[model samples]
Target: MTDTSSKPILILGGTGKTGRRLAERLTAKDVPVRIGSRSGSPRFDWEVPATWGLAMQGVGAIYISYYPDIAVPGAAETVGAFARLAVANGVTRLVLLSGRGETEAQRAEEMVKASGADWTILRCAWFSQNFSEGFLVESLLGGEVALPVGNVGEPFIDADDIADAAFVALTEPGHVGQLYELTGPRLLSFADAVAEIAKAAGRDIRYIKVSHDEFAAAMAAHELPPEITWLLNELFTEVLDGRNEALTDGVQRVLGRAPKDFSAYANETAATGIWSN
Candidate 1:
């Protein structure tokens, strides 16, 4: 009932996990979609400001999923300026994918709130896909995953649920001016998560818990891009230190069901052979 029949919906990061899912869902429902990626026609690149006007042309709503994360350097400024542009170009609604416990992400959220557009914020914890779809994939394939996080259990969220929440926020009416802190129904430590993957995949995977120093050193040795390495270090050493242990009902509150558990995600993704040899 939100009357989007008149404007194209721009999905930033439309090729990434959440954005891709969101675009699919919207298109399935016959909502108009414009994928905002460097490769798309009328391309959208966060690093390039000029491309934004083309992406925003005829867009009435936006799903802003910043790559590398809103916590990365310059993300807030870039998202802030983009929001201003969207409002200037007649974008009336925005739903931003933000990181939980990230001050930089919060700064970007503030920008959206002040953009004078109707908005919803989905503040997400570390994703369960980190193992199946994200940085954990290479380490799992290599037989060992290492991180600074130890006993701190993160309530890992599903990108599917994040996408669902985003869809509702973008298409529904009451979600305006709300912030949903989305997490799974239960908490699991990194070791437990790895073990769950192993159980699901029928493989022996090892999770190596190291001191923050050792983890950073190993990341440097791997020659990861400096920014990505720094983000990994900061997220593990700073954000994963028991700051987000408790579970929330945001998923249920938003979508009328509990979030999918890590066990469920592990089993489903394993069935797809993503974790298999």
Candidate 2:
């Protein structure tokens, strides 16, 4: 055994998708888990660095899943500084949730690797959960989805697989200093993904491909928070330019299995009555 029983693991962004799943998985394995959130016991907050140390106390491993994303401005500095502190506080291993094709996220990954702690980076593609748990949820439930993405095929990844990959890296010994580009086994365009979701949900759904300006205007009309709206627009416009259309064998390479299919995710999520008529 690797003797992780000596100290608990701190999971940053424990309320978010990957973090939440990671926490659940770790807890299921009887690994002591400390949720690093403002609502947690020690109350870890990324915007407020003072809280980090308190939450990190007695933690030997950390699952660093930054909210919004590591691609956001100032995330690299925040993560870098926190990694140093976590290592100083006796954290021995770190698993970072990073974004695919994101230069900024790549910078943060490098910082984690240089933190003098055992590190594994799960560089993931756009998540399949976006339609069920994130931005596209409402639109999917509304029967029409509009986006700036057009004909750009993305190997949309499952958060569950991301969590699984993180589990292996966090608990295993041979995964140190590795960057795994985690993605789904197949590629699907935005429209194709929505169509799959619609079929799974047993509802008639439509996808509208619009210009970036139009998408931004629609989001503004919905009173979406300005910063979030700006970020979403930037991601769709700048990041979805066919940069992540290709597939990879990262899931197989890491876990000895292929990544989950989008259809499976759609069907499973639909069974939850998320997009019910």
Q: Best-fitting candidate, measured by TM-score?
A: 1
Question: Per-residue lDDT for 1-277 in model 2, tens only?
Answer: 1236767778888888888998899889998888888888889888888888889888778889887678887788889999999889777588888998777898998888888978888899999998888988989888999898889999999999999998888777788878899999889998999999999999999999998888878988999876688678768877899888899989998999989999999999999999996
Best by lDDT: 1
**What local distance difference test score does each model get?**
0.88, 0.87
* TM-score for each candidate, following the candidate numbering: 0.97, 0.97
Lowest summed lDDT across 10 adjacent residues in model 1 is found at: 1-10
Cα RMSD for candidates in order: 1.1, 1.3
lDDT of 1: 0.88
lDDT of 2: 0.87
Model 2, residue 89: what's the lDDT? 78
Q: Clashing residue pairs in candidate 1, if any?
A: none
lDDT of 1 at 147: 80
Candidate 2's displacement at residue 110, Å, is 1.6
